[model samples]
Target: MRETLGAEDPSLEVTDLDAATAAPGDLSTLASPSLFGEPRLIRVGGVERLSEAFLNEALRYVESPADGATVVLRHAGGVRGKKLLDAVRGGAGGGIEVPCAEVKRDADRSAFASGEFRAAGRRVAPGALRVLVSAFQGDLAELASACQQLIADTTGDIRESTVQTYYAGRMETDAFAVADAALAGRAGEALVLLRHAIDSGADPVPIVAALAMKLRSMAKVLDAKGPAARIASEHGMAPWQIDRARRDAQGWETAGIGRAIVFAAETDERVKGAARDPEYAVERLVRFIAARGGAG
Candidate 1:
């Protein structure tokens, strides 16, 4: 909004108000015509903790606002500001309602990263957006900062390789470690690591991706009848990765890999908000994968 509103104008002044202690007079000066005829932008933050006097003053200010000043009322959305909110909502003048909802889905975080890039006049590829979202999941601020930094530092479009270069193997290794634990038939250990990764602010989508990637690699090599180098090249994996997948697939028949893949897919859906408890869903996936390995 500041960008669109021409914040660079020398005549524009900004004021921050703590609504709890701010009186009507304090707010009145903000909306009043500046003696020097400058425009004012007043931001009244924490309206949810507003005092009666503050609310009354805001209401009064709403009745007759100054032409040269713009007043912005901020709230954290709670019951404490019910009266003030209702009054503003019911006002004849009407106000712009900007709703900032929490981001819960993988797609949401991706869209957020895309928006940040778009706002900075940069184009980002879908793969890069996904990588950025996964790298900074559950933390919008960090994601936004990274996006802006890329915008300021780089020119033109951003690709998945660029994002990979920026974050530098952030949480992907941890996510893969969880997948390794589950695939090695250590369900109990996998659960503990999964919990630790999640509680440490790891994104569930990437964790699920790591598992799927591991299983897919295993399935590929398990069904192959060629040299490790040729098979690894065909599957777009490193020779070492193929060798590791071969080792991990030791106890599994082709049937077990298929069943594990199915369970992993089911858990993927469950973790993406389909289940009541995503952590529980992941736990079940690990256990099922491990059990399938043992059965094979």
Candidate 2:
């Protein structure tokens, strides 16, 4: 939003103030035009914690906004600034509310990543986007930063290999590596990677979660019929994911996959504090899956 305003007004003078710390006359002083008369943008944060004086001034200012100045009051949801919020919503100051909600779901996060690339006029392959999403699942800010770095540092279309090149050492990537090694029946390699991940301060929970995701993907595609793309759409998975899971299931029996899935769930619980030794629990899971060649 600030970017849009800056693009529209080249000389936009941006001022940031915390409503909790703002003084009595701070709003009036900034709202008033300068001698040069450049358009001003006043972004006031933490309005939910606004001082009494700031609240009174904001209520009045919103009713009759200053010319050549746009004041944005950011209030995280609360009743602390109900009067000011109500006045603004009732059409005082011609103010409009813009809600910045939390992004939690994988699909939502993926869409956000896609938007970041689209906004930069860049093209990212679906497989690359999946890798990027998986590599930074829990941190939206980091995901956005990774997308931007990819946009700025590289040229042309982004690929799966490109994401791997940049984020191979990331914890999530490492977790997936552990999963891949275990699924490929390489118990020793998976154990080494698992120990390294834990020693690197990787959380056991996400590691187990990564294992669960990989195991569940295989289960979903186990008996799935039709084209990869069609099945992927039906299951809310990427085609690449469907193809990879199918390949990973080549040497596995149905009963083995089921057992692994159940074990993955138990490991997930253990890592989330259900057991006394989470790391030991994770090692057990890695060896178990590898022993069965990731069958279930």
Candidate 3:
């Protein structure tokens, strides 16, 4: 938003104030019409922990906002200043609220990354988006930063290889890579990656969790029919997931996918605590899946 505002007017002045330490009349002074009358943006953060003076002043300022100034009050969702929130939300200031909810779900994060590319007038392959999302997982800020970096540093349509080139050796991507190798019957490479991941301080829990997630996806697409996109929607999966699972399902029987799922569950338990040698248990799980749930 700040970038957009700046792009529109290079002379746009921005003032950042902390509601927690703001003195009385600070807002009014900045918000009041300047002699030069340049466009200004007043950003007040920590509104959720606003001081009494700020709260009182803000309530009044909202009623009669300054011209040529955009006063943005950022409250991170709390009841600290209910009166101000109510007044602003009740249309007293004719302001629109932009909600910044936490992005916790995989689908939401995928959508976020896609939106970032779309906003930049760029395109990312679904596989690239998938791996990028898995690579960042829980850190939306990091994901957004990664997207921005890619947009700024690279050119052309983003592909899976692009993401892998940028973030191949990360722990998260390594986990998924190990799973992919194992499920595709590349046991030797999978085991090597698995040990390397562990040596790099990657926890066995997430490694096993990654394997289990793939196993579940494989199982879900076992008997699925129709177009990949339609089947993916029915099974709550991405089209890429369905396509990848189908490719991994080749040369494997129904019983094999089922057995792999069971072994994944067992390995998940062992890695959590059931087995003293969790590393060994995961190796066995990899070998089992690599054999397509048959004798190695």
Per-candidate total of colliding backbone pairs = 0, 6, 0
The TM-score that candidate 2 achieves is 0.69
Residue 128's C-alpha lDDT in candidate 1? Answer: 72
How well is each residue in 236-290 modelled by candidate 2, as lDDT tens digits?
7667678888987878778888899899898888888899999999999998899
Please give the TM-score that candidate 1 achieves against the real structure. 0.43
Report the poorest 10 consecutive residues by lDDT, candidate 2: 287-296
Q: Residue 21 CA error for candidate 3 (Å)? A: 16
What residue runs in model 1 are displaced by over 4 Å at the alpha carbon?
A: 1-169, 293-296
Cα lDDT, model 1, residue 254: 89
**2 against 3, candidate with superior TM-score:** 3
User: Candidate 2's error at 30, in angstroms?
Assistant: 12
lDDT of 1: 0.75
The TM-score, computed over Cα atoms with residue i paired to residue i, of candidate 3 is: 0.71
lDDT of 3: 0.85
On residues 1-296, what C-alpha lDDT tens digit does candidate 3 reach at each position? 65687788877887878898999999999988777887889888788889999999999998899888888887866789889988987988797777888777666788889999998789999889989998998546568778978998899999989998998766788899898899899999999999999998888887888888887777778787889989877876667778888887888788988888888898889999999999999899999989999866
Q: Pick the candidate with the highest lDDT.
A: 3
lDDT of 1 at 258: 90
Give the 10-residue window scoring lowest on summed lDDT in candidate 3: 137-146
| C-alpha lDDT of all candidate models, in order | 0.75, 0.84, 0.85
